[model samples]
Target chain A: MRRDFLLSFAGHVLVVGIAALVGMSRAVRDTRRPIVFSVSVVSGGGTPLPQAGAQGTTLVESKPKSQAKAQSTAQSKTPAKGGGGSGSGTFKRQGLGVGVEGAEALGYSYYLNAMLTRVSDNWLNPYAGQAKVLTATVVFDIERDGTVKDVKVEKKSGDAAYDASCERALLVTDKLPPLPPEFPGPRLKLHLEFEQKP
Target chain B: MVPTTGASPGFLGPFIHAGPFALVDVIALVLMSVASWAIVLRKFRTLGRASRQTRQFLSTWGLRTRLGDYEQVAQRLRHSPLSSLLLAGVKEFNALRAEFGNSQAGPELLQHMIPNITEAMERAASREVAKIEGSLAFLSITTMVAPFMGLLGTVQGVLVTFMTLRGTQIPTLQTIAPGISDALITAVMGLVVAIPAALFYNYFVGKAHELEGDMERFESELTGIMRREIVSSQVEQRKGQ
Candidate 1:
């Protein structure tokens, strides 16, 4: 009887130890935050941006003011990016300018905001002299070590210089901070829209 | 596709940093697991001991040329249910014999004692069966409770996740994955604890029944042996006359 008790106790201990070990081992290196960038580019023309990397992305083309008006009326029929089942979702740009408003947001903004700060600080406005206001969407896949990969330009600003500068800014930033150990995956796919300030 | 180095979240990390409610689930899971393990171990030892005692007693007595004296056999095989039945039947037979050999006629005395001996043996066998079945309900309860504990963790995980969404935009999958994943760990743990308990409960129940069956069969055989002994003694006495 005593022996069985000891054996049972030992078995329970072993199971718990294994669970803890497995949990600890899978921890990610970078701090993890939910992706919450509310970037809505109101550029004219339906042209899809020049995607830099491999295919298979659903990009929302630059819609004219009328379509933007139409989309807002239809917005209620669709799922909100923030409220949807999927972890990754997109929302139409609300209001004017690059200000953050009209959103219930998590502390994750700290992480994404910090990343944006790093990218924007390194950027020299590509459209400074350009007469036409252009926007380019860039997708960057970041390694756990903070190294960036496949910095593809999803939408081209129609100006090579504008597109090149956005791509260069990401590359120059070099490495991002490592993800939190508890983050889901090893690689973080970052999508950013660079709009030329008119 | 080949997974790059950091693709898989370290499997161990989420559990360590899980929320309080998920942690509650973990506590329940641990308790159930410990309980199930203890029951399995104790049941194994008990059923195993009974089986060994029964085998030892049967092998020693079943092959004998003549039935061994019940007192000596019962003393040696103290734990066996068969031994207890044997003692009960023989004791009853002796009590009846002392009262009835008011006839000195052995046949009448034997007939009178057989029915009472069988009844006494049956009662002793039932008691033995109950002893063999002791604590088995615990195993069944453990099996039933384990899965519910896991589900409790899962519900807690979802609740916590949704609660976080109250003041925030719907978070990305990577952000919420850890909590949900940790919550699921409890469920997995519950199953881990329950499956063995369920299997062992059935196994031990079967063993108890088999032991009971052996005692029941042995009771009838004992009655037959006692009748033969009485008839043989009477025939010898008549020949001498």
Candidate 2:
């Protein structure tokens, strides 16, 4: 009886230890990876977009000729056209551009862009060399104030760690540029694509 | 007894997929099931013997008018709870009557003996009931707590599952189903342990009540007999005077 008791006790201990180990390993694996949220900004003047994909940089030049043309368009479009011209043309019509401009004014695009930069810098893509290209689409809402809100991954990079890192980075940077006056916002949709170099 | 066999290959592969929580739940449930069966078998045997012995002793005691015959019957069925109660009442009555010496002294003499005998019988009955209820408390606790314990394990399993899901692109059944299955096993185990324990607890309680009622009825009958014997002795003493 004593021997039987000892054997059963040992068996139970072994079972419990193994179970604990399995559970711990699963938990550890889940927590170790990060999510990346990428934001891409495109301007209306037909400049070539950045090559770095979700994490690239673009410079916007405010040239005199472009500003003059934008002012003339605003003046021509206005019905009540005297003192309200400057405020309406520059702040409302010019500020509201399509794509990233609409996204930025709602405060979503800027926040998302900042987030993507941080996530990419943190880790190198392990599959960069082996895989030809990795692409992910991010969906987000732009509020009227030009802030990005409710950013989510519409598609994934397939790697569990990479996917999570993308999401986490998006969540951290939730700010974007003000919407141009042309678009009214409760929510607006913008699609961002991220590509890794082969 | 059914011989233990190796787990079937088809089921074993799936069972291996179940995590540690699921495995523990399965083992605990199996052990509890076996224990419940053992307890049920043992209880049936004990209660059956007690009922048979009590019936036999009562029949034999009723046939003989002499107290000595009843005493002998009580000795033969000492293991029986009913017999134990009867023996206790009879011994108390005999002791009290001997102390008073000659029932011709008065009705007061028999009155004290009746209460003392009743008290002794009741005490003995309670002790016997408690003994019959042995290990039943543990069974009751097992029934109540096993499910909750399983629930704790399941909750932990679910949390791990969700956390893992958050890191993945698309949450699929392959990754999430095992944790859900693991959690459910605990609840099943709890119900398994509790159901039989509750049924047996009620059964044992009913048996105990029946035995107690028998003891009470037997005590009343013994008191009536003592009253008649005392009255007859007193009437004979008056005639002699």
Global lDDT scores for all candidate models: 0.63, 0.53
Q: DockQ, per-model, please?
A: 0.23, 0.01
Question: Where does model 2 exceed 4 Å of error?
Answer: A1-198, B1-38, B61-68, B102-108, B239-241
| lDDT (Cα, 0-100) at A193 in candidate 1 | 73
- Model 1 spans > 4 angstroms off: A1-3, A18-140, A149-174, A177-186, A191-198, B1-29, B63-65, B69-77, B98-103, B160-179
Tens digits of per-residue lDDT for model 2, B69-97? 66667778987786777778777877877
> How does chain B score by TM in each prediction?
0.83, 0.79
Q: Give me the iRMSD of candidate 2, please.
A: 21.0
Q: How far is candidate 2 from the true structure (C-alpha RMSD, Å)?
A: 18.5
Fnat, one value per model? 0.47, 0.00
lDDT of 1 by residue, B1-241 (tens): 1112234456554566567877777777777677667777786777787788889888877744345576887888888888889888888877776776445686667776688889999999888887888778878887898888877888887777667757654344544665677667778877877898889889998998889888877888888887776676677767867
Candidate 1 at B191: error in angstroms? 2.5
